[model samples]
Target: MMITMKQNSRAPNAITSLDVYLNSLKVGVIVRTPGDFSAFSLNESYRQTGGHPVLSLSLRAASGGLRKDPKPVSKTVPAFFANLLPEDKLREAMEKHHAEAVRPGNDFDLLAALGADLPGAIRVVPSEGSLAVQPVREEGKGKARFSLAGVQMKLSVMKNTGKGGGLTLPLDDNDGQYIAKFPSTAFPGVSENEFANLALAEAISMEVPERELVEKSDFAGIPEDFDTMSDGKVLLIRRFDRDEGHSRIHIEDMAQVFGIYPARKYDGAAYHDIASALNVAISPSAALEFVRRLTLAVITGNGDMHLKNWSLIYRGDGNTPALSPVYDLLSTVPYIPADGMALSLGGERSFKALTADRWKAFAHRARMPEPAVLRAVTDTVALVNENWWQLPERAHVPDRVLDRIDAHIKTLTPILTSCANS
Candidate 1:
């Protein structure tokens, strides 16, 4: 089952082109050089129809123009393209299952493996005259091609047959509408932890996707390790990037927009950097939303809000995109006490050291109104203080975990209150 580089009939080493589809429409083509460098060009018809640009500001311009590159715009492959592939444990699973070794930084192989069902409306397929991109399919299903980027041990699965039913794993199918995250063996009840965290965010009136905690019995034929405990529960997060009809909607992460690799998601950047990028790539509302989410992350003890965790969803009206609904919201402090904030906030990774002055400085750097920034922080802190405890109570989080989080929240309350009062 070894997968070798596909050769085109025209030339052995001829450039390989993959048709990039936005839902059913072919919007562009990503070309791969003999040296394995990838570059994208918008389709002429899509350009004429004034379709939205696929890549973000760093690789593609607002006017539907790709960055000028004597070589490819990106040295290996575009960060946007690279960010779509599976990473860490999931990647190892993909390679083992497909029997194809994904080369380091080789986006071509990664896309060929799971290009059919990506995060957004964009789908990559081999163009005519290029080597055909074949996906490993199940017997009755067309192609079971899907990949979710991240280090987390999770799987994409279809929703329950009816309301209040259980979710089914789509291991042999590609039409999944939800992402199921298992409880980590290393951290007991992590599924419940994330569910409660997301529920808390929703209670605070934050834009978060619908989620549920389903019992392991709901799913059939899943691996034993996936259901770590005898009574383990799975957190099912509905895909927000999909439309009402379950069609793919375009979305890109902050790492892709900032032209940074996923490996460097937590390094060499700060909250202000993402806010500034949002201002330039999206609208004022989106930038403001970014500020609010950042505040929420700080107070909720979510130290894993890295670049890949924040994303922009394309509205299909043009190049303009909006901030996506919050996903992967969880308190990491309880599990890893030594863990700091994923990205520095106002040049401070320590949650305790964050002050009003630092927030104002971040606002200045992001070109946002200072008063509005302060209000967002104050509002978020107030909401968390008022309703945070209700989340654990409602979700029935373990008493031990609840006590630890409550203690952590207490320490954070005075700091946030002082910042708001200032």
Candidate 2:
């Protein structure tokens, strides 16, 4: 997987610029600046197009609408692109293995290296005069070129059908139809927790991805380094951003929607902010979806519903967006013991702080009817209560996690009853 010294030396054969694309539409070009950083220029025609994906909501004009200036970025790697790349050990592993290709300090190079298949429909390919993307390297290292914008060790995988069908990190040129997340030693049984949580969500009829819990051996082209989890299982989520035929359906998490850096995912903004944004830009139904999921988090003790965990999915040629399928729904109180809400609800950051007043404040801020808000809360509690017993007793979840969820449900049950009586 090593790149030759000639390409590293920039011997007139290294990638210097990249053509950014949304699906087949030309979006823009990213070029190296005089200061050896990066800058992006939006294609005038694309900018003028009524429904073109503008890469991110952050790029929209301050006045809002289709107008985009694409402010000249001066980072070693732009923040938008930086958010698209993995963080921490995942990034280090990618850089270490693809040393000759992608690297840190300048994420533009990294994006170019792995841009063939990226999140959403965004594709970044080397413009010319360079061979940034090399042939399929030995082993599965070549498949590591795809990117997912989080600190977690995640992979985009393609699923097989018929016979002994399983998932594989495709060595050929196709985006993963499913996103595979492995179990964490730091937080054991996270996959199981998410599987159970998603089961509840599906039972409630909330929009959610098709999910499966499979063994690590289920993967066909997984790297040897990641084969440590012999008995451990992986969670496979059908990619919502891809169509039935596997074409890209563009998406941007609220973090990308707000133009905030990934480090600030937990900082700044609250649930009210999300509701307000969804009301104005997306739809009232999207905001209602937020309420349903937020209620699920409160009752399940899932305290990590940060901005990055919520997303807006763009479908068709229309610029309209909808709340994306739920993901990362594991209960955090099991691990943190005292875990609460990731963002404040009505300005409170505690699970015990979820009261009638908070729901009133949240509905007031979002400009939704209080009865509608109350209905969402009551329905969520009812759905989980009804579905809990239906989940398999041997759901692969840890006993402590189940106990925590039961406690939250008990805590919320009376509250819902109190509100109904009042």
Candidate 2, residue 121: how far the Cα is off, in Å = 1.0
TM-scores of the candidates are 0.86, 0.89
Clashes of each: 0, 0
Best prediction by lDDT: 2
Off by over 4 Å in 1: 1-15, 47-55, 60-66, 73-76, 100-106, 129-143, 160-166, 171-173, 223-231, 316-319, 392-395
lDDT of 1 by residue, 67-132 (tens): 543247544556677788888877666655544334444567667656667887767666763433
List residue ranges in candidate 2 displaced over 4 A. Answer: 1-14, 51-54, 62-64, 129-131, 134-143, 160-165, 225-230
CA RMSD of all predictions: 4.8, 4.2
RMSD of 2: 4.2
The 0-to-1 C-alpha lDDT of every candidate, in the order given, reads 0.71, 0.75
- Per-residue lDDT of candidate 2, residues 1-422 (tens digit): 21112242231125668777788877778887676667777788786774366467777765765544456676555566667777776667666556665545457767777776788888776665244554336653554567787777778888888998978776535678888888888877888889988888888898889998988877786765344342467888888888998788888888878877777888768898999899888878788888989988988888899988998888887377888889988788878978889888887878877887888888998798888888888888888888876687326788877787777778867775454543
Error of 2 at 246 (Å): 2.0
